[model samples]
Target chain A: MSRRARAGVESRIDAPAGDGAPGGSGPGWPPWACRLAGVAIVVHLSALLAGVMGVAPASPLERAAMEWFGPYHAFFDLGYSYRFYIEPPPTPVAVATLHFDDGRPDETVRLPAREIRGPRMRHQRELALAHSLFVDARQAKEQTGDISQSRLARSYADRICQIRPGCEMVVWRVVQHLIPDRDQVRDALDSPGAGRFDLFDDSLFATPEWIGDFPCHGR
Target chain B: MPRPLIEIRRYLAELSVSTRAGWNRFFFAPADPTALGLIRAAVGLLAFWSLLVMGLDLDAYLGSGGWESAELAWSSLRPFAWSFWFLVGDAWLRPAWIGCLVVLLFFTLGIFSRTTSVLSWMIVVSTVRRAPAALFGFDQIVSMLLLYLAATGASGQAFALDRYWRRWREAKRTIRAIPARYRKDGLGRAVEPDTPGLPAATVSANLALRLIQIHLVMIYAIAGLAKLQGVSWWNGEAVWRMMATGEFVMFDFTPLARWPMALSALTHGSLALELVYPALIWPRLTRPIMLTGVACLHVGIAVVNPGLSEFALVMIAANLAFVPGLYVRRLAIAHEQPAVRVLFDGACPRCRGWMALLTAADPCHVLAAVDLTAVDVRTVHPALTEAGCLKAMHAVTASGRVTAGFDALRAILLRLPLFWPVALLGYFPGVAWAGRIGYNRYAASRPRDVPCTDSVCGIHSRTSPPAARDRSRSHAPNNATAIQEDS
Candidate 1:
């Protein structure tokens, strides 16, 4: 390890190697773009995770961020799954009975369950999401205050209007729960003016007026 | 700057260089074409099928007066920055939708590949924004796959017309280049580019594959983490409930519903798979087994759930990244003559440059190399000589013939199966004579740094065990002592 040998090595490198291609790390100073992309992707992943966690009592900033980026959550949350009545056997869940201006008063009207369960291509996916929003809000309402459920119900009304075309106004949004209890379900269906054998709407839990188009959709 | 601050600055600079090197190794390295090409064809067709399924209810879902009207969709998605429906009116919507359908067909067929790929992705984004309710995990997965595919231009490298078109042109050009002697024999005209498994590796393809791999891991991790929070997942009753559900119920599973133990086992098993998938899919040894397990799980979902076939297929397509192209190539070309090993002085700057150039040029990768200057050279080849190795390039053939200097390099080039026409051109009467003189003169022109010490050798610090050294130093062209079959 003499000075002479080290100098020789340096001199050899200094001499033109005649290699045509550029030195290693081709493309000078492009790491900025990569760093930017890297940061953006990380932020996106974090926002999606936050959405899936559905953080309650979130800070004002967190809520605002979620509201803005929440729609993008669908792509990231593909792994987030929610299947209906998966355990303890299938149970009947209540649906919002759609009563239109054309329908008679005091007559039973319900969400189209048949269309929701129809053949593959013919099956309208809109009913599924509408029903999901309805059930989710109602379930949340059981633990939280009435405010959360009311907001969700309003959103559902708008969504349903968008799905059911020419449905200018809704007569009522009151719906009764369908319990799994055989005796209770039978009583509700067999009652004088019952809606369906499995599920029927009651006037006990009447949500507020949902007469016009959603604010976003503009009547 | 103060002394301490200057030292800290130097340390930070070194760290930056190291980090950049690591990033390049992980993300910017070239990827083999086999897996990239396979993924493109399989995933592209699956995406096309998904588009078709969405098309069946296109008007009902995305039309102006349909269930999910354009106006309503736009309003609902106003928070988002962009939507294709915002650009086109009802009159233009049908044509746009039809254009997407046509573009997707071209994407699957790999026509105007890069252009069609971008168009296909645009269509996917439009569909997602317009009919958000109609989408499932399947749609999301196809879009994600297409996103990665669009980033890579070589997606159509295999099972594609693009490959054949390029091959035909290359063949025609190569035949024209051959000297009249070989041309008259018709050997040059009969030749074709053997690009099947030997896809030229590309940085873009490699980066896209790495992204897909990381994304897949994240998805599984999140899925498993999410399931762990659910109450039904704890008792395995959730599995039964999915089968017994209303709209999702494709088959009667009342019998499984009766067996609490079986259902619980399945539910827990599902959770376990999702959690462990990310961990097991990294190592080369376990990657295959992990992907097979994934395939089975997806297939089970597809079979039990009638409408989820597309989802299952696309997921399996994503797993294609884990399949090793090199392993597949070796398996496909088994029993061929083992590649000869070349030994060179990696410490020499010129030699290092030669290694880099030769590494890229050898498409079929016929020659293997080792650094003669490495300390472990003695361990790898007990009989390898220091002086002879430093003197010139040396390649030991599989049949154990020692070819020296320029011929050592030529031996490697000559071994390429597909580009033998080009090789023959180099080996021709006049070209061979000129090439030898040029290579010998280049070798002789180097300064004789005879008192070569440990400090002079660049690879002096790099001491590796035989197996590890062989794998890493296989890129280093070797010297006179040892020649083993390329691993």
Candidate 2:
């Protein structure tokens, strides 16, 4: 194409020549279209604000706004609460012990197994799965029932039974790994270089809370 | 009209006009799609990697017999959320997974970008929806980015095969019409030719980038505000707490316990940076500081929390939203081929015209052209003689290897987006031999340069063709003398 024609095309696409918020005039959509788009943008921004605000520990007003904008968030799959490290809780992990139907030794499996060799992203997925088991436990506690009876746990146990064909039964529990305070770490370690206190010390863990036990059958 | 009533009417009119103009500038003002294209390419690759990893445990994660049964996972999505995996049987699982991977690969490569980007997003959403139990912050950020990229529909305008294909087609047509143009006008009227700068800009590109920027600000604001509710964040123990968490920790952070003050600083600094980012990021002055702070915070998290490394990478990628398109375009170009220097005979108008075409074709800015006539050719490389450079083009590659003649042209074409197809063809068996012979003949056929002592030579020198003038001007002062000489 000729340079002038190309330059004309480019100039047509140039941003408005001005500063922020008050005025910036350029060739653009007609007034009505701009107004229509402005309204849509306002609504979408409001929905985004409400979606974040509606995360738990929210006030009644935020909750109501979220409810109003629920469909928008749901459709876009934008249910991000953005609550990174908020009220950080003790780490919860599921430990599964498999007993084989054959004359094989029992094997222990962690849902987010440290031995789950691969990319950290894959490990992160396993961690999320482990978290679901913990979520199941938390929900069970809220409802004052056995975690084994929860649908998540049942489905999880069933899947475990189906996959490890040799396994006759599967038993799993949720354990919370508590973070020791500064004082506790200082007291436990003999010196800065001492091996006395490791971050993974077994003493920092809560007792394992049983989630479920299931016998493997060809479902 | 009364004075007060007239004043009120004027005020209202001004407000209305300003508001309309501001709205158009913010959302509808056109921007180069380079930044959005960068994001699309990155997010597409991330999505591809993410889906590929899921394939490792496809049966265990998305299969009907997987960790969470399809029935249960599908049922939980309820009325609003949907996934193609919900309907796929065990038999179709691998095929569906492979298809999504193929689409994502194309999206990453910018092949049929507009359609593939949407498909890539759909595939991402479907996969995430189906395997919700496997989600983390990575999923959230990836989804958000994909939404904006797909919405823009112009993400393929820069650094994409879609763009390359379009330009390639234009070049093909232009080449085909050249003979006809020559037939029409002896040498054809030498009008100004197109040279590369930024890609075409559009309102959709602006809107997409704006949406991503706003969304990222909201994320930071929300995350920061949410952290304020916790005692750990207030006391500067949150970072330590996260470090000590078993599932996420890559290395034991117990030694960090001794450096509580440093921990506190990190904790407080992260919180403060997040809190201020939404406000500070809009200003040009504070944007770099905020982006640096963000990189540090996320990279720190990634180092300590390996499981959340993907999340950290996603957050860093999202922050690119705040970066200007010009910088992103330059960065993308610089990354493609940073160390190739082309030595050309600047005195030759034909050579200068060829250089003009090359510079226009090279969106990546891969070649750094050094004029053979302007400098001591030996200074560029001990091996480079002025006579050798004048005879054929020479290119010094990143590895310090020198290529000449057809090989040099082929090397240059490999880096230019439009010439990749032709360049690839030169690599086929005996094609290089034929190409080298053809290049030698063409070089030999060019008229030799001679000093202007007659009206014919003077006219030819003065004409200097439009492309030669433009190309020579982009070089050193000596090139002006080169432009005055006849060929």
Candidate 3:
């Protein structure tokens, strides 16, 4: 065999230390360091597993594991639930309209713009903020029977007011733009811009539901 | 002792010893550092890009009065959650951001890498924690990779400027000490300098890769299991729903609106890929197929949703842990070392012979010989004149640095690993000056296939030598592009 092929084979082999591997390890670790590292690895892996399993629909054991390991996960920012596209994505998108006091025109901003063509992360970031507000609203409604009392919604509005210097108050609302089923798509096939079907149809969106209204700090 | 009790005790003891050994082999086996270095460079670049984009609107997302106020963010933090942004006053925010960017730049370049990697990770964590409302999977994966890089401590050992600088310094030091050592020993033989080779394998490198691989498995398994709880995923409508969603959709999938079977197939294929990935990726025979499936899946996701491109790229990069370090090392070399193109006179037989030798020496194909006659010389560089190239050979580096005659030869030699010693010797105090003079004389005497009536020939010789020009060999040069085009 050629030298290159031989080196490749040597690299692949799980030989003992100092066996002339391509990237050879000189000597094995001391027993004390090995034992300490082994313990650390075990703990870290266990914490990671617990954090992942602790999302909704978890078992009792998983929940208990998370309770014990939650602090470590939070500190290191290793607490990923990995619930990506687990369910049908939510149809309703939240948006806020800003009202100005200093003769600036009233502006409306969608969390994720309808047609985000550039720097799409800006849209994703905005979408995350809006989703947080929606979650807060839902939780508040469930707990106190009033979605307007959501603290996150108020904080969001207040922050917006600060961003727009002359803004007096901000209004938050949720608009449902549900995805069309196959039948709906077929029905709208002959409509204008049929290739996009009802993607741009104004009637696709339901009436916006008011979440909250909050006044600016100074004003 | 009772016979049964003694037998049970021996069985337990054997199992304990075997398990401990297995754990040590799995986690502490020495592995190549090139893989970690590759991961570090990629993750560092991504981190830099992430932070740069975030900096575009720093005041809005991270400012004290912007999205999440200081009080609001502080109140929502988990007990141990911390951020430098919390303590920075309004006046210091930009300065702090500039400092983070500088550290991230150094980390990406692998300069002061050990310290920069740690600092870069801390910066990412602080920014992400500071503005929790504006993060996605991209931020999380970058942070995870950075954490591993910092832990490895050998992430800058390969495909790094640090490695090159260290090697150069060591070579210089050895060169300086050679005379002193030779005089002390009074030896007849020359001393051989200690040439740096591939980075040594370390337990830390193995530990980092194993951790990343295990973490990836966990992520995929959990994601796949979580999908089982959704009605759309069960009914195979998940793919259609994602494509139909206006916010995430990139193209008009209305054409596929009537084709539910195709959509269902895609949906089921994705779900199956994710569910089987964690289990199949561990086996030697199945690892390649699993990784390919992941690449295809993530690429499709990115195409369908451009916003998730960063997230998809990070996921693909994380999967590099399963790839062997040797293959990654080859890729690192190919990517890190840019090709040096040597512009030579295709009409000169001596130059073609020289080109053939250079090509033979370059097993890695780092040198590309561009025939001046095959294409417009001006296209390569507007300043390049055919007559000047014919007078003295020229080489252009990847960064557009041009050198001529002996310097060009030195540049080419530096790229060919086999001729590194000769290249280094040429760099000595008076060797290059003498070499340049020798090269000029050689160029003046060399024969060209073109006639002496040509304007370029008049500069070298006032009259032609007593021989007819070989027109047939003039256009037919044996360089990289000639054989393919002519034959």
Taking all chains together, each candidate's TM-score versus the true structure is 0.57, 0.78, 0.76
Per-model TM-score (chain A alone): 0.35, 0.78, 0.79
List the TM values for chain B, per candidate: 0.62, 0.73, 0.69
Interface RMSD of candidate 1, in Å, is: 11.0
- Give the CAPRI rating of model 3: acceptable
Q: Provide the DockQ value for model 3.
A: 0.38
Give the lDDT of residue A201 in candidate 2: 74
lDDT tens digits, residue span B1-487, model 1: 8999999999999889866755655565555656666677677787666666556656655666554456656776644334565577667767877777788777776677788877777777677777764556776777777777775565765435565456555544543332231321122112333333245555566666776787787778767876666777885656665554444445655444346677678778877888899787775556667888889878877766655677788889888876656554454332454466677654344554455444433334455656564434444355556555666777766666777687777776666433345667777788878888897677655532122233332223333446644543443323211222221
Better of 1 and 3 by lDDT: 3
lDDT string, candidate 2, A107-131, tens digits: 9888777677678778888888888
List model 2 lDDT by residue over B1-487, tens digit each.
9999999999999889766656676688766676677788788888999899889889988899788888888778745777878889999999999999999999988899889988988888887888787778888899988988887687786778776555545544443343233222111112112323347566667778888888998999988998898998989898888877766787877777788898889889999999999888876667789999999999999998877777787888878767767676444454645457788754455665566566655655577767665666687788887667766889888778899999999998887755778889989999999999998777655542333344423333233445655543443244334434522
Best by the DockQ measure: 3
Among residues 3 or more apart in sequence or in different chains, the pairs in candidate 2 whose N, CA or C atoms overlap within 3 Å are: none
Clashes of 2: 0
DockQ of candidate 1 (2 decimals): 0.06
Which residue window of length 10 is worst by lDDT in model 2 chain B? B183-192
Q: Give the C-alpha interface root-mean-square deviation per candidate.
A: 11.0, 5.3, 3.3
Error of 3 at B404 (Å): 6.4
* Model 3 chain B lowest lDDT segment of ten: B184-193
